[model samples]
Target: MNYNESLEKLLSLTDSERVSGRGQHTRRYDLTRMRVLLDELGNPHLNTPTVHITGTKGKGSTAALIASVLSSQGYKPGLFTSPHLHTFRERINFDGEPITADEFAALIEDIWPVLTSINHDGSHGFITTFELLTAMAFLHFERKKAGFQIVEVGLGGSLDSTNVVQPQVCVFTSISLDHTAILGDTEEKIARDKSGIIKDGCVVVTSPQQPQVMNVIAQACQDHGTAFVQSSEECTCTLSSADLYGQNFDIVAPWGEFSFRTPLLGAHQLENATTALVTLQVLNELGFTVTSDSFARGFRSVQWPGRLEVLSEDPLLIIDGAHNPHSIGKLKEALHDYFQFRRVVYVLGFSSDKNISAMIQELPYDNAEVVVTRSRHPRSASVETLASEFSRLGVSVKQLDTVNEAVQYAMDLAQPDDLIAVTGSLFVVAEAREFLLNIPPELYPSLDAGMPIR
Candidate 1:
């Protein structure tokens, strides 16, 4: 079968992402099934060293940053992230290129028989969809002889399918309340779950966090006999300048001082950049050769599309995939710091499971014109629901049927100097970005993946 057919086979399984990632029972995340699948695949997870990153936010960017540096330094690092902006291939990349559609089709075909057996036989309690994909990633990395793998946890770290690997370095970006029903409602509990990736002998690096969150991370590292380094404590970043185009900063770490520049906007990215840099230093201590020049080149070259990315300048349109309240707050901060406008129009949509009310409160609304819409994503929150939430905040809200409609309305309403911020879920931002840039949605040659396997 071709790529689309292969994806259909995969999506016709138990997928939590498609169902809003709620109703996640304990049994749904059992790692035994994943372990069994990996063993059947000849334990490909063991073939490569790992850098595992987990957090409510910034994990993807951190993974991208590390992968960029490693690639620039002549290392073949397999990078795995989740909840793609446009396609399933975005979740799996090596040497800065996403796996081609044919490669994906072949991987699925080769593993289908074994994957089916694991799911049907029930000897291992049935592997879930994500577990199967994780297995595929390991197998692909092994096939490629990847020097190291930089993996971002799909959900919480403890029982995430990707947690099967014992990482040499574990990274945590800013932790907050996300995936609350499955992970936890409180920040401390969530921190505990995310900290579960800290295995023995691994070095831990974390962005500056709340005191309580830091406590949980420290205790977890202590329990695992892992070394922990807090990024803000170990390194200081001085932002020389920032604009919608990019930002330039200087970092002072234990090893030395270095200047860095990246097209990734926002203040939170500074934390992510420092966390990545500190982790790379830890990798160097563990005997990976990453020169200062590679660091400079990597920062300049790393591309994390759809995170505070500018798609147009005439109307000052920017899109970010800030789905949760904390991330929305950070998005607000970035807007305030990086751009100026007298009036703003927000093209907003969200997934059904997200805390819409809280996020509405977090999002800035002064002189804000609201256009509510639903993305085509299966879990997209209803336009009516979003409109009501914004109305409750004393904001005048207009309803549009789709992201494309909402973006057009927002553009018509905004002046050249006004900002049109398209955000909420990445799914919505993906649709908006595609429409704005005239790029087709980036599935696997016209395909997609849904469901978790169990």
Candidate 2:
């Protein structure tokens, strides 16, 4: 079968959403079926060294940075992430390229019959689409002879499908209040869930998380007898987020102090870069030597989209996937910290389960105009619902049915110095970016290309 046809067939065979629904029921919290499926595929995950990353916000960026550093260190790395902005193949990468059509075809041919046989029997061995995809990734990376595999948790860590791998190093970026429905609303509860990836004798690395969250991780490390490394105080970096390209004032690390610059704008990204640096340092201490030159080369080349990405030049169209209250708070702070505007225009959309009102409240829109919109997702909250919420907040909102319409409306009101920020859901930001920048979603290869996987 062709690539798209094969993916369609696999997606149709089982409910893809069930893969990410583990947090709903403990009965479904086991990985036996996925393990068996991988065994049938020759247990590819066991063939490669692995790094597992789990966190509320920075997991994607952290995984990308680590994989990039590994590539710079002359290792062929494989990266697997989630919720592709364009194609399903984006979830898997080999040597920094999205799996080709021929590769996807070969992978599906190998796994499809096995999945069919398991489903035909009366066994409770059903695997979700994400699990199947994860299995496919293991098979792909193993076939490509990867030096290392960087895996990002699809959801909260404890029962996430990607947790099946025993990682060489387990890294948690930061714990936040997102996914409260599944992981509980408290920071402690969420921290406990993220700490589930720590195994005995493994090295644990973390950024400067909240005090409560840090305590949870520390307790987990002690309980598991794992070596835990927090961000070094001297590894701090200062960030200057100007309207144009931002400058990262990098401080000295275990290797040494050095400043690096990138197009990534925002203070949160600076923190993320530090988290990646500390994690790499832990990896080095574990005998994986990544030199300062390799680190600098990778840091400058790493590209993580849909996070404070600037798409246009004149009016400065910014895109961020700030779906939760904590991330939105950071987004608001970045907006106020970097640029001053006569009037700001916000094009926002969110999922039905998200804290829409809370996120909207956190947005720094004192003198700004808000345009509410809905993205192309099954769970997208209606524009009217957002309009009503903003109305209750005593903020006038303009309603648009889609991100494209909302963005155009915002641009119409934008002046030369005015700024337009599109945020709320990654789905929304993805759609807005495709429209405003005219980058066809299908043309952007995959999430794997963004990571230097393999």
Candidate 3:
């Protein structure tokens, strides 16, 4: 099968991301299905050592950090994250690059027989598109004989398909209220769901969390009899300086102290970087080699798209995928702290399943104008819905039919010195990023163009 055809067939399966509200997703998140599917494929999830990362906001960034450092040290590391910005291939990265299109299609073809057989038998329930992709990642990593697998959880930790692996280090990065309807309504409940990634033998590392969230994670570690590494308490990270281009920071760990730099913006990245440092330290102690030089280089070069990424300076354009309310607040804080501008124009959109009301409450109503819009995804929140919220807050808001139009409108409304921030969701950011960066669409043949790639 061709790449587009393979993608279409895979996406045609049951997808939880497109399913909104409560109860629906909770019913489908059974890890036994994943285990059974993996068993049929010889349990490739167990072949390589791993670092399994979970939490609401920074899981992807933390995973990218560890994978980059490991790759810098001459290890063939595979990184698996969710919600691709452009192509589905971005979900599975080798070293610093995504798996090639040819590889993806071929892998699907190779596994088609076993997959069809299980589907035909209907023993483990209908496998989801995410389950299939997770299996693909594990199998691909095994075939490549990867030195390590750095896995980011797709959803809540315990029942997430990626939780099958007993990792060398389990990481939780900045647990906050997100996916509230499906995971839980409270931070404590969300933290408990995330802490399920803490397997008995693996060391657990976490960023600084709210007191209640911390208590939940700590209790989970105790239940597993696992060693818990609190990055905030165990490591002191001091930000020396930050600018639009990059930031420099220093981390003092119990093992040693080292300086680091990353082009990624936002003060929150300091926490994610620190969390990665602690996880790498644990990985190193667990018989993996990580030199300070490699760590320094990796931190300097890692790229995680759609998070405080400055695309241009002429209009002072910035794009961030602050999908949830807590993240939107962080994006607002970062803009105020890191950049200087006369006026700001926001091109915003978000997924429908999120806490949209709380997210709207986080908008920067002062010195900002919002151009509300929707992405191609079926779950994209309506511009009317977003505009109503903005209007109620007594903010200047306008509606556009598409992300491209919204970005253009924001740019037109802003002077060259003013900033235009495209955010709210990665699906929105992906569309805007494609237009601004002159990236051609990674199109699938005859597929629902916006089939909720998360």
Q: How do the residues 1-454 of candidate 3 rate in per-residue lDDT, one tens digit apiece? A: 9888788778667777664331122335577777888998999999899999998899999899889999999898999999899888999888888998899998888877777777677666667788889999999999888999999999989888898998888999998888777789899998888888889899999899999999999999999999998988888988899888899998998889899999888889999999998888888888888999999989998999889999988889999999988899999899999999988888889888887888879866677777899988878989988888777777768899898899888877789679998888989999988999997767644446534354
Query: In order, what lDDT does every prediction score?
Result: 0.86, 0.79, 0.86
Q: After superposition, how far is residue 170 of candidate 1 from its true place, in Å?
A: 0.4
Give one digit per residue, the lDDT tens place, for model 2 in 1-454: 8775676555544443422332222235567777778778788888888888988887887788878878888888999998777667777887677888789878988898987776566265566667778888999999899999999998888887777787888988877898887888899999999898888878888878888999999999999999888774638687643545555556667677777765567777777778788877777777888887887777777767888888886777889888899889988888888776677899989888888888988976677889999876656789989988988889998999978899999988899888999999888988887787676655312222321111
| Predicted candidate 1 versus true structure: per-residue lDDT over 213-262, tens digit per residue | 99999999999888989899999998899877899999998899999899
TM-score of each: 0.95, 0.92, 0.96
Q: So what's the TM-score on candidate 3?
A: 0.96
Candidate 2 wrong stretches, greater than 4 Å = 13-27, 232-234, 240-243, 441-454
Worst 10 residues of 2 by lDDT: 445-454
Colliding residue pairs in candidate 1: 14-452, 15-451, 15-452, 128-453, 128-454, 129-452, 129-453
What would you estimate as the lDDT of candidate 1? 0.86
Model 3, C-alpha of 52: deviation from truth (Å) = 0.3
What does each candidate score in C-alpha RMSD? 2.8, 4.4, 2.1
Instruction: Point out the higher-scoring one by TM-score: 1 or 3.
Output: 3
